[model samples]
Target: METLMAVVIGVLFACAIYMMLRRSIVKLVIGLIILSNAANLLIFTVAGMTRGAPPLIPEGLYAPSGIVADPLPQALILTAIVISFGVLAFSVVLIHRAYEVVGTDDLDQMKDTDT
Candidate 1:
């Protein structure tokens, strides 16, 4: 499963890079979304996959016993998700405004207006 996830993450990264290099502003946003997802997956994968109980210590114990799930990666992923959503939202609004002002979605066309 880990190997499969690694492969999937690699594929996503490649796709994201490809999309980001396109001439369309919309594709760049799409690539950013994909890149964020890939990063989340990478964090999850690096943290190791284990079926275990929550990382809660029992009463009188200083630490969790037996196989316990790690919470750090979960927290990191959650934070990343929130951050990515905000960035995606901002990008969408920015793209819409750019389209309205520049009247084009092609990045090449946008570059031509930099006179």
Candidate 2:
């Protein structure tokens, strides 16, 4: 499962990089989204996958018994998701305004208007 997840993450990262290299503003935004998702997946995969109990410890126990899932990765992923959503929302709005002003979504064409 870990191997499969690693492969999927690699593919996502490659695709995101490829999209980011495109000349279209829309594709850049999409790439940012994919990259964020890949990052989240990486954190998840690196933290390891356990089918054991949750990170909760019994009242009488000082530590959790058996294999317990790490809570840090889940917390980090949740934070990343919220941050990514905000960034994506801002990027979309910025792109929309840029499109309205520049009248084009092509980065090459946008460069020409800078003068």
Poorly placed runs, candidate 1 (over 4 Å): none
Candidate 2 lDDT over residue span 1-115, tens digit each: 9999999999999999999999999999999999999999999999988777888989999999988888999999999999999999999999999999999999999989963
Model 2 lowest lDDT segment of ten: 48-57
lDDT, candidates in the order shown: 0.96, 0.96
What local lDDT score does residue 58 receive in model 1, on the 0 to 100 scale?
A: 97
- Model 1: clashing residue pairs? none
Once fitted onto the true fold, the runs of candidate 2 whose alpha carbons sit more than 4 angstroms away are: none
Summed over model 1, clashes come to 0
- Estimate, for each residue in 9-49, the C-alpha lDDT of model 1 and write its tens digit: 99999999999999999999999999999999999999999
